[model samples]
Target: MSNSNSTPLMARVTLGRALRRLRDEVNHLTLADVAATLSCDISLISRIELGKRNCSQQHFTKLMDLYGVEESERDRLAELHAATREQRPPWWARYSEVITAEYERFLGFEAAASEVFEYQVGILPGLLQTERYARAVIGAGFASLGPDQIDALVEVREIRQRQRLWDSDQPLSCCYVLTEAALHFQVGGPQAHQEQLQFLLELQERQNVELKVIPYAKGEEGAQIAAFRIFRFADDDVPDVAFGESVAGSLTMDDPRDLRRLHRLFSNLSAAALDPDKSRDLITRIKNKED
Candidate 1:
């Protein structure tokens, strides 16, 4: 992603994980026992724990009752359950006039996620883009958009950055791993590129941000995968979500296998990337270079 605001990176609550967390707190109630008490199928409970399906209201209420959850807590859980299963289009769906369905779905999860980790292989990821760089990137990619449409898109990106940094009630924590080549492939003019690097330097000062760079090294050269992001939620109710995109479309998954692969790749990327301080130094050098 070249813009500073690509996909939203917040966790969408998962009823299954939340329910499983609660059930496990019931002092060793067996799975069969819960099914028997709730008069539901045991396999259904397993699916719920895996976040494979949504639970019905009747069953959800019964589960809450079985867990002896507080009335107030039950009210909140009920609301969240309803939201997760909302039949209405997600907030981003309105942007379907401008964006694809895959991108729209990504926004839903990104908006609600608490923590986001990204490994960028091409240009800088959207979260770190400056306005000028963002404009340059947008202008190049979608030459067809009218000035008004482009302006609207840029405005959305700015709002996205603000929300992640501080505008939202809960600020998003971001860890970004960028390829060293991204710095060399400048988007905006020299001055704007320099300014973007300076902005990155400033952003690195924030406690919630971690920026690392993967240099062109021998053994790790082929290890870098396509850019992907992992979003984690504040509560266990939502399973961690992972997303990646290609020329065709986007791929998002919360399956255990998918998550495991992302986690391992992220871990490896962290190891391969330069530490924050070194990454900053590299950026400074690139910025200072005569363009």
Candidate 2:
């Protein structure tokens, strides 16, 4: 099977899905059959269909010929395949040495997401985190990291902050549900914590950002235990992508069943969360308490 360590959004959206559907419709066309037609290993075919790897133009044209895809459809797919390789690398690619395969892939899609939904338990979401807060979080988790490594992580986080939530003309449409525990957790002492809260208050004023707080009184659910993000693209054909991180590590999901479950849980959590006005009021109260 193919692993999705760093698949791009374009390949995931068009090439992989179209090829998979076409392969499915034909009778008696197994991975073995496709591999034979492409003159490669069966694993290669699997990876191409999973969007974990891209086939050469020759291989792609050959497969289309094998599947007997319509000329018009093949042309569109060929164009998309070309674009996939041509798309510029996301900013995180520069920091690939320090970043995990999972996060690298997350950034690839984050760069393309039109709408983002997030839920957090005990730490601020990366897009909303302040410089000091991000530094503290990274430092605490990677205690052995040197100053240079720490600085790079902070820089990447700041870039993500600007691109995803603060860009004046093209910011992502964001909905965030922060648990009361996360609101109260002090990452970098009272002053730093207060500043982080103040930052969230300011970000909430943006028209594109929706900030919500799920209070302790509202209780918790299983979904609240892990911080996860659901990314929605503008085009309907591009399926929603879910990336989640927890003690066990991170994983990505595009399966409809997983997306539906996460979507439902997000809906319920949103319903339980405090509204924007009230959430800001809560943050203000916490900031004042720190003073």
**Evaluated with TM-score, which candidate comes out highest?**
2
lDDT of 1 by residue, 37-122 (tens): 98888998887666445777788888888888898878866766665565656444545667765666666667767889998887
lDDT of each structure? 0.75, 0.81
Residue lDDT tens for model 2, 1-291: 011212355455557777877887664488898888777999988878777687788888888888888889888777767766765776687887789877777787787778899988889889888999999999998899999999999999999888667663567889998888898888988889889988898888889989999887886542366888899876555678898887777788988899999999999999998899998998898888877
Q: State each model's C-alpha RMSD to the native.
A: 6.2, 3.8
After aligning candidate 1 to the native by TM-score, how far in Å is the CA of 254 from where it should be? 1.2
- Our tally of clashes for model 2 stands at 0
Per-candidate TM equals 0.74, 0.91
Please report the TM-score between candidate 2 and the true structure.
Answer: 0.91
Task: Write out the backbone clash pairs for model 2.
Answer: none
TM-score of predicted structure 1: 0.74
Candidate 1, position 28, lDDT: 63
Which portions of model 2 miss their true places by more than 4 Å?
1-9, 25-30, 221-223
